[model samples]
Target: MFEQKATEWVNSYSDMLYRYALPRVSDSDVAKDLVQETFLAAWRNIKTFKGEISEKNWLFTILKNKIIDHYRKAVNRLTDSFPGMADDDPYFEEGGHWAKETQPKEWGVDYNNPIEAKEFYEVLEKCKSKLKEMQNAVFTMKYMEGMESEEICKELNITPSNYWVLLHRAKVQLRACLEKNWFVK
Candidate 1:
């Protein structure tokens, strides 16, 4: 019975899980693998299914953890490459304000307009792809997944200060990329 139910979940939830994972991981193969892993994990832990939550929700939760694990591995790899790299505040001044030259320019985008908003998002995705692995992971977790700072720090095994630095640098790099690619164009 558990095997049948798990198989049914694959047929029902695979596409949804794939869609959820793809944008987060930005790789079709990785997304598919995560979905497969999620199902495998659900099947192995079938005895734990107490029905407090729907099977779909439980599967999604498992997939989310898989995605977090993916990000954690990527972050670890990056840190391993550049051990003890300093997180310098290059974009801020002594008073913690944006440095004169680094002040953000107005985007003047009409987000309410679907066409413009869509174009902006396309540009944003391109910019996001340009970020370093760790910065991208941190930014996506906080802004895209809506994960809290504490949760992200805990999951990523990063200090709170490190999380803030990564988020800040990601935003700074993204802003610059958008300005050059979107605003200038």
Candidate 2:
């Protein structure tokens, strides 16, 4: 009986689930795996699904948690030995202060306005994609998902020091990329 209902979910929700997972995981194979795992988990807990929410929303909620788990595992597996910047880090001077020549230029942004330039988010995503795996995961977890520092540290199996370093480096790289692609140009 439940088997039949689960099968119906595959037919009804797999594509939508895949679409949702792909952009978040940024990989087709991982997205497919997540969708399959979602269904399997749903099957195991099928008795607990009380239909308070629509089946689609229930499945989607399960899949979202699965995706977060996938990222957590991937981040745990990654080494925290971030690469050096090869001495061209424009944001800092020799003494670690903001470089006068490289201070961020003011943008003509309207803070009072509700909307921003659409291209800003596009460029930000592009910048995010260029980050290293661990940096990307940490950045997304902290800023995008609004996870706490301790939660991120625990999820990634990283020390607090390591988490701060990754966040700093991700910010530096993202700022440089956005300035080059969006602000400076």
Model 1 per-residue lDDT tens digits across residues 66-103 = 99999988767763532223545656788888877667
Candidate 2 Cα misplacement greater than 4 A, ranges: 1-23, 52-57, 79-90, 99-102, 114-119
lDDT per residue (tens digit) for residues 1-185 in model 2: 76687678889999999977765665679889999999999888978989999989999989878877987777656564544324455578888887886677775666587447777776777787788767777777787668899998887677898788778878987887877788787
TM-scores of all predicted structures: 0.77, 0.73
Inter-residue clash pairs, candidate 2: none
Span of ten consecutive residues with least summed lDDT in model 2:
80-89
Cα displacement (angstroms), candidate 2, residue 96, comes to 1.3
What number of backbone clashes does candidate 2 have, counting pairs of residues 3 or more apart or in separate chains? Answer: 0
The 0-to-1 C-alpha lDDT of every candidate, in the order given, reads 0.82, 0.78
